[model samples]
Target: MLRRLALTAVVSLAVLSAAAPGAAAASGPLPLPSPLPLTLPLPLPQGEDDARTRLTVTVSEAGDPSAEGIFELECAPVGGDHPAAEPACDRLAELADEGTDPFAPVPRGAMCTQQFGGPATARITGTWRARHIDAVFSRADGCEISRWNNLRPVLPGVR
Candidate 1:
């Protein structure tokens, strides 16, 4: 069921793209998203700074001062300032393809408890795949902890 929904979404996007002005007619297979090069040059004046994945991370632990850092991730060649840039880019790309939102809030009715997994709290803010992302994650509950772990590569010192 989820697979079908994803396929439908992709197909709809293709159709909408084809309908755009000056768009070439649809060919055999719907054009797949071309992998972005490690360095993207948006010389068309999109009015943005460098076209790299730039991010900031802030983590706080109970009874400890907050730790903060930054990372720049590039996907194609998988080179950036991220410690695990290669794997991180691969994981991030996979999630993006699966339509996962890095900043998605916990699902409603999740089986979460008030138990504290740890005293870790983090805020991540950045540009990913041309979109701005600003999110906060905490280990105050099972669901939030799971979400924080999922983005471990991007958020160091959260454990």
Candidate 2:
């Protein structure tokens, strides 16, 4: 009787352990890829002798890459004695004009260029922002951009 009881307990434990993982996985939606944060230092407008101002730029892809995905850019000033205290956050529709479906994954090395300042010739920076900048491939539902990890002190130099 003792031997039979021990064998039954062991078999029950094995089955429960094997089924636990699958049951948990099916209980909820799959996880999504983590967001990426990129920090950039904006140079003081030319001729201004003030110290450089730090602007943190975070890029996050909304739930799947669709024409309706909300791509947000947030700029916050760090350190330095600047009057710009309000952090600017802007949300633009991803591929608004292309009419492309959003469910598709963003192409590898997808390039996006944003220009600052007024009309006429301005400083043109190449490869300013690119999707999958880290070359990480993720098949999750959506992407997000936040200051969760990439925070650092501002340094003197052009980013």
lDDT at residue 34 of model 1 (Cα atoms):
46
Q: Residue by residue across 15-59, what tens digits does model 1's lDDT show?
A: 888787445543454666443223332232365433455565555
Query: Compared to the true structure, candidate 1 yields what TM-score?
Result: 0.54
Q: Which regions of candidate 1 deviate over 4 angstroms?
A: 1-52, 62-68, 72-80, 157-159
Would you list the C-alpha lDDT of every candidate in the order shown? 0.65, 0.28
Best candidate (score: TM-score): 1
Overall local distance difference test of candidate 2: 0.28
Instruction: Give the poorly placed runs of model 2, Cα more than 4 Å off.
Output: 28-36, 40-159
Clash pairs (backbone) in predicted model 1: none
- For model 2, residues 46-146, the per-residue Cα lDDT tens digits are 56422222233222332222211122222222232212223211111222123322223344543322332111111111111222112222223222111
Q: Judge candidate 2 at residue 81 and give its lDDT.
A: 28
